[model samples]
Target: MRRRFKLATLTAALCLLLVSLSGCGQSLAQKDILQLDRHSNEITWGVKADTKLFGLMDVRDNQIKGFDVDMAKHITKHILGTKGQAKFIQVTSQSRIPLLKNGNIDAIIATMTITPERAKIVDFSNSYFDAGQSLLVPNGSDIKNVRDLNKPGMTVLGVVGANSVQNIKKYAPKARVLELQDYAQALTSLKAGQGQALTTDNGILYGMAVQNPGFKVVGGTFTKEPYGVAVNKGQRPFVREINKAIKEMQADGEYNALIKKWFGNVPGFNYKELER
Candidate 1:
């Protein structure tokens, strides 16, 4: 009787263990494809809602529209197998990575610069858009470029939590950097005479210049800032799909069409320079 009782207990324990292992395996499988096609046939893509030309919300149409938006949508169609139902989530430069890591966003197509530090935390697609750092100053201002910013007592304004602030130290070691909370605040500070110049990507600076004609990008691109689509680390399948979509767009003229749609007419920057 004692032996039979022990045997029954062991059999029940083994069954429970097997069930637990099976449940764990199913969870892992679900996690692997959580960001794929599981959500209403929609892909939630991260895009900048404030940065004009690249990714901005069109209030009139109630839709986000720009170069990045169009490109992301194109990639979604290729990856998700359709584009009509995908969604856009407004993401800032500081929030893009966290959103992707937390599963709040499927992918980030914001003007995110690919860096080794960022790559360690998130997987980046092949370089999709190539840009460079530039300086923006009031029209007729004396600051010509980054070289002019390397002077004691000169104040350079950059957006907080952006790579631009970090890169500024390399270019202007002697200048004082004042980082604003966001691009809007940075622009306000620039207008209020808080800094000698505002530094960011040339493409973004062009958007600012267009809105405020009094400001213009000077000393053209000093540092290369290659933009890439970001996904959570270890998502190899998603990364591969994004890269393939980008390559297809590049080969089929879709990439150039987006560039022209947003950037073709922007003043002070040569569109032809971005070909290929």
Candidate 2:
């Protein structure tokens, strides 16, 4: 009887172990973004809701609009056909990676730059947009470029969690850096005279400039900031599909058209330079 009880206990523990292993396998399979999207026929994307020319909330329509949003929709069509829905969830720089890691978002297309540090945590798609770090200053200000901000007592505004803030440290070692929550807040602070210059990607600066004519993007790009779509570390399939879709769009001229549609008329910007 003692031997039989021991045998029964051992058998039950083994069964529990197998069940736990099976659960783990199911969890991993569920996290495979490509398979998940296929099964649901939808791609949930994390995108910026504050940056103009990239992604911005359209208050009138209660929908987000901009280049990133459009690109995501087209990519969804390419990947999942006409029926596959592209769902956009607003994400800030601070939240995007965490949200992705936690399975809250399938991918990130929020003007995110691919850096070695970030690559360690998540996989990135091929460069979809070529951008560069630059500065925005009030017109007629003596600060013509990034170099001007290197002087002591000069204050530069940057968005928190954006690589631009880190990049600025290399260029303006002596300048005081103030990090804001978003582009809107940075621009507001800049306008309020809280900082002498606002720094970020030239494309984003240009978007701000277009709306606020008093300010302008200066100091042509200081660092290359090639934007890429980000997926969880193990999601190679999703990354490949995104890369493939980008190439198709470029090949068919859809990419250039989107570029023109959003950027063609911006003052002081050469839209053709961005066209594929």
Candidate 3:
């Protein structure tokens, strides 16, 4: 009787262990966002809170608003069948990758440039916005463009962890470089005379120019910085869904409408080709 009881206990314990393992395996396999509406109901997204035009916080409305924000909202609506269901997590360029990797964000809709180097770390959706590197300088400054900054002792301010500093070196090898913490800090340093110019994407520079009339983006783009949405590597289904959403927006005129809403009136920027 004692042996039979022991055998029964062991059998029950083995069954429980198998059930637990099976549950874990199912959870792992069910992680991808195959059904947008259902999954986004439980997921949160990471978006830029600082980037102007692309992403910015609307202090008066107490909501984050911009082109990227609108785009993300639209994507959520299309995928989840509702817009307000998913939550938004504010992210910076330096924090986007880490947050996505740690599973804090379901996806990134910031103005992240797609590059081969970054591709090794995170998966990128199709290019949503085309942009290029450019220079921003104080109004009436003699430095009209990159060519003028090729001389030694010329200082350039760039954000840390961004490829902008490296591109600055390649294009203006003689200029002294100062890396700031973020775009706001870079602008502050530039205004404080820490650097002769600021280097970043033209879209962002344009936004800055609109805000601070004292600064202007000079010269055309020096390097293409195609912006793309990023997800964790191997999340092919999520990437595909985002790409499909972008393509649909482009085809349905929503993409061009967003471009016009943010960039149509910006001086010197031609928004013709961006129209659907």
TM-scores for every predicted model: 0.87, 0.90, 0.85
Among residues 3 or more apart in sequence or in different chains, the pairs in candidate 2 whose N, CA or C atoms overlap within 3 Å are: none
**Model 2 regions more than 4 Å off:** 1-30
lDDT for position 135 in model 1: 92
The candidates, ranked best first by TM-score, are: 2, 1, 3
Consecutive 10-residue window with the lowest summed lDDT within model 2: 24-33
Best by TM-score: 2
Clashing pairs in 1: none
Clashing pairs in 3: 37-80
Q: Over 4 Å off in model 1, which ranges?
A: 1-30
Q: Which rank order by lDDT, best down to worst?
A: 2, 1, 3
**Highest lDDT among the candidates is held by which one?**
2
lDDT of 2 by residue, 171-270 (tens): 9999999999888898899999999999999899999998898998887888999999999887898899999999999999999999999999888888
